[model samples]
Target chain A: GAGVSQSPRYKVAKRGQDVALRCDPISGHVSLFWYQQALGQGPEFLTYFQNEAQLDKSGLPSDRFFAERPEGSVSTLKIQRTQQEDSAVYLCASSQLVEGGEPQHFGDGTRLSIL
Target chain B: AQSVTQLDSQVPVFEEAPVELRCNYSSSVSVYLFWYVQYPNQGLQLLLKYLSGSTLVKGINGFEAEFNKSQTSFHLRKPSVHISDTAEYFCAVSLDYKLSFGAGTTVTVRA
Candidate 1:
Protein backbone atom coordinates (compact mmCIF):
# COMPACT_ATOMS: atom_id res chain seq x y z
CA GLY A 1 0.00 0.00 0.00
CA ALA A 2 1.10 3.56 -0.62
CA GLY A 3 0.17 4.58 2.91
CA VAL A 4 0.29 2.99 6.35
CA SER A 5 -1.98 -0.01 6.76
CA GLN A 6 -3.70 -1.35 9.89
CA SER A 7 -5.54 -4.60 10.32
CA PRO A 8 -8.99 -5.31 11.82
CA ARG A 9 -10.63 -1.93 11.42
CA TYR A 10 -12.93 -2.84 14.29
CA LYS A 11 -12.75 -5.35 17.12
CA VAL A 12 -14.98 -6.31 19.98
CA ALA A 13 -13.93 -8.27 23.02
CA LYS A 14 -15.12 -8.96 26.52
CA ARG A 15 -13.24 -8.02 29.64
CA GLY A 16 -10.17 -10.16 30.47
CA GLN A 17 -9.75 -11.02 26.80
CA ASP A 18 -6.53 -10.27 24.99
CA VAL A 19 -6.29 -8.46 21.67
CA ALA A 20 -3.51 -7.85 19.21
CA LEU A 21 -3.51 -5.10 16.61
CA ARG A 22 -1.25 -5.00 13.59
CA CYS A 23 0.36 -2.17 11.66
CA ASP A 24 2.19 -2.31 8.33
CA PRO A 25 4.09 0.87 7.71
CA ILE A 26 4.97 2.37 4.37
CA SER A 27 7.83 0.72 2.50
CA GLY A 28 11.23 1.82 3.79
CA HIS A 29 9.83 3.95 6.57
CA VAL A 30 12.28 4.10 9.45
CA SER A 31 10.02 5.45 12.16
CA LEU A 32 6.80 3.95 13.44
CA PHE A 33 4.57 5.18 16.27
CA TRP A 34 1.48 3.89 18.05
CA TYR A 35 -1.15 5.98 19.76
CA GLN A 36 -4.43 5.57 21.65
CA GLN A 37 -7.41 7.83 21.18
CA ALA A 38 -10.27 7.70 23.61
CA LEU A 39 -13.66 9.04 22.76
CA GLY A 40 -13.82 12.85 22.60
CA GLN A 41 -10.09 13.09 23.06
CA GLY A 42 -6.97 13.44 20.97
CA PRO A 43 -4.57 10.65 20.14
CA GLU A 44 -1.98 10.00 22.82
CA PHE A 45 1.38 8.46 22.03
CA LEU A 46 1.75 4.91 23.27
CA THR A 47 5.15 3.91 21.93
CA TYR A 48 7.67 4.61 19.19
CA PHE A 49 9.97 2.40 17.19
CA GLN A 50 13.06 3.41 15.27
CA ASN A 51 13.71 0.69 12.76
CA GLU A 52 13.55 -2.53 14.81
CA ALA A 53 14.48 -0.89 18.07
CA GLN A 54 11.84 0.18 20.57
CA LEU A 55 13.11 3.66 21.27
CA ASP A 56 10.37 4.93 23.55
CA LYS A 57 7.55 3.31 25.44
CA SER A 58 6.98 5.86 28.17
CA GLY A 59 3.56 6.88 26.98
CA LEU A 60 2.18 3.40 27.46
CA PRO A 61 -0.52 3.52 30.13
CA SER A 62 0.54 0.32 31.79
CA ASP A 63 2.48 -2.89 31.51
CA ARG A 64 -0.54 -4.56 29.99
CA PHE A 65 0.19 -2.83 26.71
CA PHE A 66 3.00 -4.33 24.68
CA ALA A 67 4.26 -3.51 21.19
CA GLU A 68 6.95 -4.99 18.98
CA ARG A 69 8.47 -4.46 15.56
CA PRO A 70 10.97 -7.25 15.00
CA GLU A 71 11.41 -6.55 11.27
CA GLY A 72 11.03 -2.74 11.53
CA SER A 73 8.32 -2.83 8.87
CA VAL A 74 5.45 -4.58 10.63
CA SER A 75 4.42 -3.85 14.21
CA THR A 76 1.91 -5.26 16.66
CA LEU A 77 0.33 -3.89 19.80
CA LYS A 78 -0.92 -6.50 22.20
CA ILE A 79 -2.98 -5.94 25.30
CA GLN A 80 -3.36 -8.48 28.10
CA ARG A 81 -6.31 -8.76 30.47
CA THR A 82 -8.04 -5.97 28.66
CA GLN A 83 -10.25 -3.71 30.73
CA GLN A 84 -13.05 -1.43 29.69
CA GLU A 85 -10.76 1.54 30.01
CA ASP A 86 -8.57 -0.06 27.38
CA SER A 87 -11.23 0.47 24.78
CA ALA A 88 -10.17 3.10 22.29
CA VAL A 89 -8.98 3.64 18.76
CA TYR A 90 -5.44 2.43 18.22
CA LEU A 91 -3.59 4.46 15.63
CA CYS A 92 -0.37 3.70 13.78
CA ALA A 93 1.85 6.15 11.94
CA SER A 94 5.07 5.96 9.97
CA SER A 95 7.56 8.53 8.79
CA GLN A 96 10.36 8.27 6.27
CA LEU A 97 12.91 10.12 8.39
CA VAL A 98 14.20 9.35 11.86
CA GLU A 99 14.25 13.03 12.75
CA GLY A 100 11.62 14.81 14.77
CA GLY A 101 10.22 17.37 12.35
CA GLU A 102 9.09 15.08 9.57
CA PRO A 103 5.34 14.68 9.13
CA GLN A 104 3.96 11.20 9.80
CA HIS A 105 1.52 9.30 7.62
CA PHE A 106 -1.19 7.55 9.61
CA GLY A 107 -3.44 4.55 9.16
CA ASP A 108 -7.21 4.45 9.53
CA GLY A 109 -6.73 2.78 12.95
CA THR A 110 -8.33 -0.14 14.76
CA ARG A 111 -11.32 0.73 16.89
CA LEU A 112 -11.55 -1.66 19.83
CA SER A 113 -14.66 -2.09 21.89
CA ILE A 114 -14.58 -3.79 25.27
CA LEU A 115 -17.86 -5.16 26.46
CA ALA B 1 7.91 17.99 28.54
CA GLN B 2 5.47 19.44 26.03
CA SER B 3 1.70 19.83 26.03
CA VAL B 4 -0.92 21.33 23.71
CA THR B 5 -4.23 22.99 24.43
CA GLN B 6 -6.92 23.66 21.88
CA LEU B 7 -9.22 26.44 23.13
CA ASP B 8 -12.32 25.71 21.11
CA SER B 9 -13.90 22.31 21.29
CA GLN B 10 -16.26 23.01 18.43
CA VAL B 11 -16.74 25.72 15.82
CA PRO B 12 -19.66 26.14 13.47
CA VAL B 13 -19.16 28.10 10.28
CA PHE B 14 -20.96 28.74 7.03
CA GLU B 15 -19.62 27.82 3.64
CA GLU B 16 -17.21 30.37 2.16
CA ALA B 17 -16.74 31.92 5.58
CA PRO B 18 -13.46 32.21 7.35
CA VAL B 19 -12.62 29.81 10.19
CA GLU B 20 -9.93 29.64 12.80
CA LEU B 21 -8.93 26.88 15.21
CA ARG B 22 -6.95 28.03 18.21
CA CYS B 23 -4.08 25.98 19.66
CA ASN B 24 -1.62 26.79 22.40
CA TYR B 25 1.38 24.88 23.66
CA SER B 26 3.74 24.79 26.62
CA SER B 27 7.33 23.70 26.32
CA SER B 28 10.53 24.76 28.00
CA VAL B 29 12.85 23.84 25.15
CA SER B 30 12.55 24.12 21.39
CA VAL B 31 9.52 22.39 19.91
CA TYR B 32 7.95 21.29 16.64
CA LEU B 33 4.31 22.15 16.06
CA PHE B 34 1.85 20.35 13.84
CA TRP B 35 -1.79 20.44 12.80
CA TYR B 36 -3.70 17.37 11.67
CA VAL B 37 -7.20 16.79 10.39
CA GLN B 38 -9.25 13.63 10.76
CA TYR B 39 -12.40 12.85 8.95
CA PRO B 40 -15.06 10.48 10.24
CA ASN B 41 -13.73 6.92 10.59
CA GLN B 42 -10.37 7.96 9.11
CA GLY B 43 -6.89 8.68 10.29
CA LEU B 44 -5.30 12.01 10.84
CA GLN B 45 -3.79 13.81 7.88
CA LEU B 46 -1.11 16.44 8.26
CA LEU B 47 -2.36 19.95 7.71
CA LEU B 48 0.88 21.86 8.34
CA LYS B 49 3.95 22.02 10.51
CA TYR B 50 6.31 24.59 12.03
CA LEU B 51 9.80 23.22 12.38
CA SER B 52 12.16 26.14 11.81
CA GLY B 53 12.94 29.28 9.79
CA SER B 54 9.34 30.28 9.09
CA THR B 55 6.56 31.04 11.51
CA LEU B 56 3.87 31.06 8.84
CA VAL B 57 3.30 27.63 7.36
CA LYS B 58 1.11 26.72 4.44
CA GLY B 59 -0.41 23.30 3.98
CA ILE B 60 -2.53 21.35 1.54
CA ASN B 61 -6.23 22.00 0.96
CA GLY B 62 -5.67 25.77 1.18
CA PHE B 63 -5.12 25.77 4.92
CA GLU B 64 -2.45 27.74 6.75
CA ALA B 65 -1.21 28.39 10.28
CA GLU B 66 0.94 30.88 12.15
CA PHE B 67 3.42 30.04 14.88
CA ASN B 68 3.53 32.58 17.67
CA LYS B 69 6.37 32.24 20.11
CA SER B 70 5.42 34.95 22.57
CA GLN B 71 1.85 33.79 22.88
CA THR B 72 2.85 30.15 22.61
CA SER B 73 0.22 29.54 20.00
CA PHE B 74 -0.07 27.91 16.58
CA HIS B 75 -3.57 28.60 15.37
CA LEU B 76 -4.85 27.18 12.09
CA ARG B 77 -6.83 29.31 9.71
CA LYS B 78 -8.53 29.29 6.35
CA PRO B 79 -9.81 32.32 4.49
CA SER B 80 -12.76 30.37 3.23
CA VAL B 81 -14.11 26.98 4.16
CA HIS B 82 -16.16 24.42 2.29
CA ILE B 83 -18.37 21.61 3.41
CA SER B 84 -15.53 19.26 2.74
CA ASP B 85 -13.52 21.08 5.40
CA THR B 86 -15.76 19.80 8.16
CA ALA B 87 -13.68 17.52 10.32
CA GLU B 88 -11.85 17.20 13.60
CA TYR B 89 -8.55 19.03 13.94
CA PHE B 90 -5.78 18.29 16.38
CA CYS B 91 -2.78 20.34 17.47
CA ALA B 92 0.40 18.69 18.65
CA VAL B 93 3.82 19.62 19.96
CA SER B 94 6.97 17.59 20.05
CA LEU B 95 9.93 18.17 22.32
CA ASP B 96 11.83 15.10 21.21
CA TYR B 97 10.65 12.01 19.37
CA LYS B 98 7.19 11.75 20.88
CA LEU B 99 4.30 14.13 20.33
CA SER B 100 1.75 15.43 22.82
CA PHE B 101 -1.59 16.44 21.40
CA GLY B 102 -4.45 18.69 22.43
CA ALA B 103 -7.99 17.43 22.86
CA GLY B 104 -9.05 18.47 19.34
CA THR B 105 -11.48 20.87 17.70
CA THR B 106 -14.45 19.82 15.64
CA VAL B 107 -15.23 22.12 12.72
CA THR B 108 -18.64 21.95 11.12
CA VAL B 109 -19.19 23.82 7.90
CA ARG B 110 -22.80 24.35 6.91
CA ALA B 111 -23.80 24.91 3.32
Candidate 2:
Protein backbone atom coordinates (compact mmCIF):
# COMPACT_ATOMS: atom_id res chain seq x y z
CA GLY A 1 0.00 0.00 0.00
CA ALA A 2 1.14 3.52 -0.73
CA GLY A 3 -0.23 4.64 2.59
CA VAL A 4 -1.94 3.19 5.67
CA SER A 5 -5.33 1.82 4.71
CA GLN A 6 -8.21 1.47 7.19
CA SER A 7 -11.36 -0.49 6.58
CA PRO A 8 -14.96 0.46 7.23
CA ARG A 9 -14.60 4.23 7.16
CA TYR A 10 -17.74 4.47 9.27
CA LYS A 11 -19.44 2.20 11.81
CA VAL A 12 -22.63 2.35 13.82
CA ALA A 13 -23.16 -0.10 16.64
CA LYS A 14 -25.83 -0.49 19.27
CA ARG A 15 -24.73 -0.35 22.89
CA GLY A 16 -23.15 -3.62 24.00
CA GLN A 17 -22.42 -4.65 20.43
CA ASP A 18 -18.92 -5.59 19.42
CA VAL A 19 -17.12 -3.79 16.61
CA ALA A 20 -13.87 -4.48 14.87
CA LEU A 21 -11.89 -2.02 12.78
CA ARG A 22 -9.08 -2.99 10.48
CA CYS A 23 -5.86 -1.39 9.30
CA ASP A 24 -3.47 -2.35 6.52
CA PRO A 25 -0.22 -0.55 7.00
CA ILE A 26 2.14 0.44 4.23
CA SER A 27 4.21 -2.50 3.10
CA GLY A 28 7.28 -3.18 5.21
CA HIS A 29 6.33 -0.76 7.95
CA VAL A 30 7.91 -1.86 11.22
CA SER A 31 5.90 0.16 13.69
CA LEU A 32 2.12 0.27 13.95
CA PHE A 33 -0.01 2.42 16.26
CA TRP A 34 -3.60 2.93 17.21
CA TYR A 35 -5.22 6.12 18.48
CA GLN A 36 -8.63 7.40 19.51
CA GLN A 37 -9.86 10.86 18.52
CA ALA A 38 -12.94 12.34 20.10
CA LEU A 39 -14.84 15.25 18.61
CA GLY A 40 -12.75 18.42 18.69
CA GLN A 41 -9.85 16.63 20.35
CA GLY A 42 -6.42 15.43 19.31
CA PRO A 43 -5.65 11.80 18.74
CA GLU A 44 -4.81 9.97 21.94
CA PHE A 45 -2.38 7.08 21.94
CA LEU A 46 -3.97 3.70 22.48
CA THR A 47 -1.48 0.96 21.71
CA TYR A 48 1.60 0.18 19.65
CA PHE A 49 3.11 -2.83 17.92
CA GLN A 50 6.64 -3.43 16.81
CA ASN A 51 6.46 -6.34 14.43
CA GLU A 52 4.09 -8.85 16.11
CA ALA A 53 4.80 -7.92 19.69
CA GLN A 54 2.55 -5.50 21.52
CA LEU A 55 5.06 -3.11 23.03
CA ASP A 56 2.76 -0.60 24.76
CA LYS A 57 -0.86 -0.88 25.74
CA SER A 58 -0.81 1.53 28.65
CA GLY A 59 -2.82 4.12 26.77
CA LEU A 60 -5.74 1.81 26.15
CA PRO A 61 -8.71 3.35 27.91
CA SER A 62 -10.05 0.12 29.38
CA ASP A 63 -10.32 -3.63 29.09
CA ARG A 64 -12.96 -3.30 26.43
CA PHE A 65 -10.48 -2.09 23.82
CA PHE A 66 -8.03 -4.55 22.32
CA ALA A 67 -5.70 -4.34 19.31
CA GLU A 68 -3.61 -6.96 17.57
CA ARG A 69 -1.23 -7.09 14.64
CA PRO A 70 -0.73 -10.78 14.16
CA GLU A 71 1.47 -10.68 11.06
CA GLY A 72 2.98 -7.21 11.47
CA SER A 73 1.29 -6.14 8.26
CA VAL A 74 -2.37 -5.78 9.09
CA SER A 75 -3.93 -4.84 12.43
CA THR A 76 -7.30 -4.95 14.05
CA LEU A 77 -8.86 -2.88 16.80
CA LYS A 78 -11.76 -4.51 18.59
CA ILE A 79 -14.10 -2.85 20.99
CA GLN A 80 -16.48 -4.97 23.03
CA ARG A 81 -19.73 -3.87 24.59
CA THR A 82 -19.57 -0.48 23.03
CA GLN A 83 -21.04 2.47 24.87
CA GLN A 84 -22.24 5.92 23.86
CA GLU A 85 -19.03 7.43 25.10
CA ASP A 86 -17.10 5.08 22.84
CA SER A 87 -18.16 7.04 19.77
CA ALA A 88 -15.02 8.38 18.18
CA VAL A 89 -12.64 8.10 15.28
CA TYR A 90 -10.24 5.20 15.55
CA LEU A 91 -6.97 6.13 13.85
CA CYS A 92 -4.23 3.80 12.62
CA ALA A 93 -0.70 4.90 11.80
CA SER A 94 2.43 3.17 10.60
CA SER A 95 6.08 4.03 10.49
CA GLN A 96 8.83 2.57 8.36
CA LEU A 97 11.09 2.53 11.40
CA VAL A 98 10.16 1.99 15.03
CA GLU A 99 12.48 4.69 16.31
CA GLY A 100 11.16 7.96 17.74
CA GLY A 101 12.38 10.22 14.95
CA GLU A 102 10.67 8.41 12.09
CA PRO A 103 7.61 9.98 10.53
CA GLN A 104 4.24 8.28 10.87
CA HIS A 105 1.72 7.84 8.10
CA PHE A 106 -1.90 7.84 9.19
CA GLY A 107 -5.07 6.40 7.71
CA ASP A 108 -8.26 8.37 7.32
CA GLY A 109 -9.66 6.46 10.33
CA THR A 110 -12.90 4.70 11.15
CA ARG A 111 -15.63 6.79 12.65
CA LEU A 112 -17.46 4.69 15.25
CA SER A 113 -20.87 5.74 16.37
CA ILE A 114 -22.35 3.89 19.33
CA LEU A 115 -26.03 4.34 19.79
CA ALA B 1 6.31 12.04 31.34
CA GLN B 2 5.69 14.34 28.41
CA SER B 3 2.71 16.55 27.63
CA VAL B 4 1.92 19.21 25.01
CA THR B 5 -0.28 22.27 25.29
CA GLN B 6 -1.56 24.21 22.26
CA LEU B 7 -2.38 27.67 23.56
CA ASP B 8 -5.05 28.58 21.05
CA SER B 9 -8.19 26.60 20.41
CA GLN B 10 -9.08 28.63 17.35
CA VAL B 11 -7.31 31.19 15.17
CA PRO B 12 -8.87 33.15 12.38
CA VAL B 13 -6.81 35.13 9.89
CA PHE B 14 -7.36 36.84 6.57
CA GLU B 15 -5.96 35.25 3.47
CA GLU B 16 -2.32 36.00 2.67
CA ALA B 17 -1.71 37.06 6.28
CA PRO B 18 0.89 35.68 8.61
CA VAL B 19 -0.23 33.34 11.37
CA GLU B 20 1.26 31.46 14.25
CA LEU B 21 0.02 28.55 16.30
CA ARG B 22 1.52 28.34 19.78
CA CYS B 23 2.55 25.07 21.40
CA ASN B 24 4.40 24.30 24.58
CA TYR B 25 5.52 21.12 26.21
CA SER B 26 6.73 19.88 29.60
CA SER B 27 9.25 17.11 29.89
CA SER B 28 12.01 15.91 32.15
CA VAL B 29 14.26 14.69 29.37
CA SER B 30 15.15 15.85 25.90
CA VAL B 31 12.30 15.14 23.47
CA TYR B 32 11.39 15.25 19.79
CA LEU B 33 8.77 17.76 18.72
CA PHE B 34 6.35 17.63 15.78
CA TRP B 35 3.50 19.45 14.13
CA TYR B 36 0.69 17.67 12.31
CA VAL B 37 -2.17 19.08 10.29
CA GLN B 38 -5.59 17.58 9.69
CA TYR B 39 -7.95 18.79 7.05
CA PRO B 40 -11.67 18.28 7.32
CA ASN B 41 -12.64 14.61 7.01
CA GLN B 42 -9.05 13.51 6.82
CA GLY B 43 -6.35 12.02 8.94
CA LEU B 44 -3.38 13.89 10.37
CA GLN B 45 -0.45 14.70 8.11
CA LEU B 46 2.97 15.47 9.44
CA LEU B 47 3.95 19.08 8.92
CA LEU B 48 7.39 19.11 10.45
CA LYS B 49 9.52 17.58 13.18
CA TYR B 50 12.55 18.58 15.18
CA LEU B 51 14.58 15.51 15.89
CA SER B 52 18.18 16.42 16.72
CA GLY B 53 19.78 18.97 14.49
CA SER B 54 18.07 22.19 13.55
CA THR B 55 15.72 24.35 15.57
CA LEU B 56 13.94 25.63 12.49
CA VAL B 57 12.14 22.94 10.50
CA LYS B 58 10.38 23.49 7.22
CA GLY B 59 7.47 21.35 6.13
CA ILE B 60 5.13 20.91 3.23
CA ASN B 61 2.75 23.62 2.02
CA GLY B 62 5.13 26.33 3.13
CA PHE B 63 4.54 25.67 6.81
CA GLU B 64 7.43 25.91 9.26
CA ALA B 65 7.98 25.42 12.96
CA GLU B 66 10.70 26.57 15.30
CA PHE B 67 11.88 24.50 18.24
CA ASN B 68 12.81 26.71 21.16
CA LYS B 69 14.47 24.61 23.82
CA SER B 70 14.69 27.34 26.46
CA GLN B 71 10.98 28.05 26.25
CA THR B 72 9.90 24.45 25.63
CA SER B 73 7.90 25.61 22.66
CA PHE B 74 7.47 24.38 19.08
CA HIS B 75 5.33 26.94 17.39
CA LEU B 76 4.13 26.55 13.79
CA ARG B 77 4.30 29.66 11.64
CA LYS B 78 3.61 30.68 8.07
CA PRO B 79 4.56 34.01 6.58
CA SER B 80 1.39 33.91 4.48
CA VAL B 81 -1.62 31.64 4.75
CA HIS B 82 -4.29 30.74 2.27
CA ILE B 83 -7.79 29.46 2.65
CA SER B 84 -6.47 26.00 1.98
CA ASP B 85 -4.45 26.27 5.14
CA THR B 86 -7.59 26.02 7.21
CA ALA B 87 -7.22 22.93 9.30
CA GLU B 88 -6.68 21.56 12.77
CA TYR B 89 -3.07 21.58 13.92
CA PHE B 90 -1.60 19.38 16.63
CA CYS B 91 1.66 19.58 18.50
CA ALA B 92 3.27 16.40 19.77
CA VAL B 93 6.17 15.42 21.98
CA SER B 94 7.98 12.12 21.96
CA LEU B 95 10.09 10.77 24.79
CA ASP B 96 11.73 7.46 24.17
CA TYR B 97 9.27 5.90 21.72
CA LYS B 98 5.89 6.90 23.07
CA LEU B 99 4.24 10.02 21.68
CA SER B 100 2.01 12.50 23.49
CA PHE B 101 -0.18 15.01 21.67
CA GLY B 102 -1.78 18.34 22.49
CA ALA B 103 -5.49 19.13 22.35
CA GLY B 104 -5.02 20.89 18.96
CA THR B 105 -5.59 24.34 17.46
CA THR B 106 -8.00 25.07 14.65
CA VAL B 107 -6.86 27.49 11.93
CA THR B 108 -9.43 29.23 9.83
CA VAL B 109 -8.30 31.43 6.98
CA ARG B 110 -10.84 33.88 5.71
CA ALA B 111 -11.07 35.92 2.55
| Docking quality tier of model 2 | medium
**In model 2, which runs have C-alpha deviations exceeding 4 angstroms?**
none
Question: Candidate 1: deviation at residue A106, Å?
Answer: 0.6
Error of 1 at B25 (Å): 0.5
Candidate 1 residue pairs in backbone clash: none
**Real contacts retained, model 1:** 0.77
| Winning model by DockQ | 1
Model 1 agreement with the true structure over A21-111: per-residue lDDT tens digits: 9999999999999999999999999999999999999889999999999988999999999999999999999999988788889999999
DockQ of candidate 2 relative to the true structure = 0.78
Q: Interface-residue RMSD per candidate?
A: 0.8, 1.0
Question: For candidate 1, what is the total of clashing residue pairs?
Answer: 0
